[model samples]
Target: MSQLVVEWDRLNHEIEEMTALVGKKDAEMALLKAQLAKAQTEGPGTEEVKELRVKNAALLS
Candidate 1:
């Protein structure tokens, strides 16, 4: 019937909108994950901390 057709069309439109939103969110998540990984890799390490402490002590002396 015509009513059923109308309902089906509305549902399909909603589904398409939701699919697009999901895709956008997925892309954002991937970008955030890559940024997090880069940050972790570029952050200071244990040796760097130790050197900084020695420099601080020398400065104090």
Candidate 2:
């Protein structure tokens, strides 16, 4: 009976540790998704880069 109680406690502890790790991973994933969305909205894109290259080439010519 004592051994069964110990085993139950050990399993409960393992479950708690795994749950905490899962929560941490979820938070990190959310942060990365937010950063990607912000960057997509704010940064230089392909069309802008192409335009800049054309202007630079014209100026050099």
> For residues 8-29, could you state the per-residue lDDT of candidate 2 as single tens digits?
9999999999999999999999
Candidate 2 minimal-lDDT segment of 10 residues: 40-49
User: How well is each residue in 3-53 modelled by candidate 1, as lDDT tens digits?
Assistant: 999999999999999999999999999999999999889988889989999
Q: What local distance difference test score does each model get?
A: 0.97, 0.98
Question: What does the lDDT read for residue 42 in candidate 1?
Answer: 98
Candidate 1 wrong stretches, greater than 4 Å: 50-61
- Which portions of model 2 show Cα errors greater than 4 Å? none
Please give me the total number of clashing residue pairs in predicted model 2: 0
- In order of appearance, the predictions have TM-scores of 0.76, 0.85
| Inter-residue clash pairs, candidate 1 | none
Candidate 1 has its poorest 10 consecutive residues by lDDT at 39-48
Q: Which residue pairs show collisions in model 2?
A: none
